[model samples]
Target: MIPAEDRAEAGRPPARVRHRRVFYVPGYDPRSPRTYFLLFSRELRKFAALHGITARMRAGKEDPATSWHVTADWPGGPVKTTVDCLSWHEIAVRDFAVPKWRVALLSLRVLWDAVWTGTVWRMLRLNWKFGIFSLYPWGMALLYALAALGLVAACLTLAGAVGLPRLAGLAPAALGLYGLLRLTEILDRRFFVWYLINDWIFTWRHRTRRDPEADARFESFARRVADAAEDPSLDEVLVIGHSSGSFVSISIVARARELMREVEGRPRLALMTVGGNTPIAVAGRQPSPARAAMQALVTDGGMLWVDYFAPQDVLNFPWLEPVAAFRLDLGGKPPRNPSVRSARFREIFSEERYAEMAYRFYELHFQFLRANDRHGEYEFYRFLAGPEPLESVTREPG
Candidate 1:
């Protein structure tokens, strides 16, 4: 048992808290928000059963259209948390709605610029695994193009062999090209070649800060976050960013901090990024908005930042320091805010469970947001619905 005086020595949050507001910014996913709602509900039940706690989801909120309130009665105390999905689902839908030809051309431009500007080589130098991941979409795109061109060539050759005029070959050539494109579409249902191309297209726009729609959406998130921080009822405001959303969340939180600076008695602000690939957007020697956001967050020094990583998750840059990778300008002083820590899946899960999860790459990436089967330091459920404050639990023992 611990004494009250010992709580501070144990690394409690700077302030006492009865409630927390969690704003979850998901990655570039087009799925409905209801999917996330159900996933969280199911995971919360498992988390409660595993920890022997009473965590009840009262109901879903219609005002925000994707929010839930949960109450957890833990060993520490009864705490309430409101989890809001700051969704850009509609924007993703718009991306998918784009004409196929335009998406192809735009994605081609992203690849050409990466190659022309030597970004792909730079990426390879930084981390070969992720550099290869970056190349996959482009590689698949080129393969499709080559297949289409080869089909046209074959059709022309057959026409010549049959004593048909060159002009007559155009008809069969067009038809063959259409059939090949259709076949590729069918194949893409499995490979997701075009889907990945669109995803990278979105990432490229964000990297350059040229997407006005994204900028406008970021502004909306900033205002919402700033309003939440000023709410007197809330004791903590935690912004969660995962995968592609990590960079977006950083921009929103940084902008929101500036908006909330003049307010009085604001809630404790904090940022937590899980399986983040922030360097993908914010890196490089070029000055961009994403890079600027990284710099601003550090200079402001108003929020506690925590980054969680896993080496097994190839989607994220594991076993690397992000600040150094992003090449952030910090006046030659080591930034003290973000406390990077491992999720320790190997230490927490049994061998059988780990083996079952191995080779299923997407499952491993999503593990950061799932419940643990055994005790661990960084369980996603415990981080969100558990009794401890984000900062208090993530802070290092001194």
Candidate 2:
């Protein structure tokens, strides 16, 4: 069983953390790091008030991304954390910069590849809601396209009925259709059609050897984690990756392990991924370095990975067990590294609060990173800027 890999020494909880280093890799979002700084800083205040503790965050160098310091005095003890958020918004904006028409065409091609290659069916079998979510943007794109074509046909018919030359309506019909298509683009801001398209395109490209430069960037993040791990004063080097950022975190942690020289007295190195389903990037027949990295970390005994899975969230795959789903070749090692834990969100929020955000999928998907209404076992902000070491917080199954 996977639990066997983490038993005994490998699963032993580290000492209560005093000084910690936190690395955050946000999802494929183009928002500025200042936004995340505000999100976390505000949430820290809410957490302190709820727990009746003292906690504060001060911004550090915050240009490309934010570097901040957090000090929290929980009932257990006082702890200080240095938090660094890796920024890739410039790269994301480049992906966003693709011509809208090209994004649609590329998205169609990518979607077709997934369906033609049985990727969609595979994903549906894994988690139906997530499969539907994957198809949501393209489905809307097709709907709007059909609406435009039907309007053009109606315009042409009206012209012919009035006894004008059928071609007489061509100019007006073309203009009307163009206006309708432009309206579709305007609607995209509300639906995030092109934005989701860019995310899938990036994921497809990253795993298919089209985004080697991103890997080059990931290596720097890995080196940073490795550097933090070797620092004896820090109790833990914790990396948190959410959404597609999970894709990068998996590879970086694996690469960091490779970069780290075997040494005694190193701080515990750990990872937490929220919103599962990242395996889509590397789940095909073709071998990929990302897939290889996943296997190494899942089977490795040195580090801990807790996949925070929220079943009600439609944006992520539910019930994903990578070792079983990906058919990772364990090579006789116990599958113990990733302790999949259910994020009991319903319990964290009051019934009214839960119902209010239940339909807001994006808000729910992001709840993993925010402070809960009630202090539950999964106090994310507490675990993040904390006296609690990752190992101790995640050692027991939730």
Best by TM-score: 2
Error of 2 at 394 (Å): 1.9
Global Cα RMSD, each model: 4.2, 2.2
Predicted model with the maximum lDDT: 2
Q: lDDT tens digits, residues 205-273, model 1?
A: 987877899889989999999999888677788899988888889889988977884455567777888
Please give, for residues 247-289, the per-residue lDDT of candidate 2 as tens digits.
Answer: 7899889999999976677788888888856856766656667
What clash pairs does model 2 have? 2-335
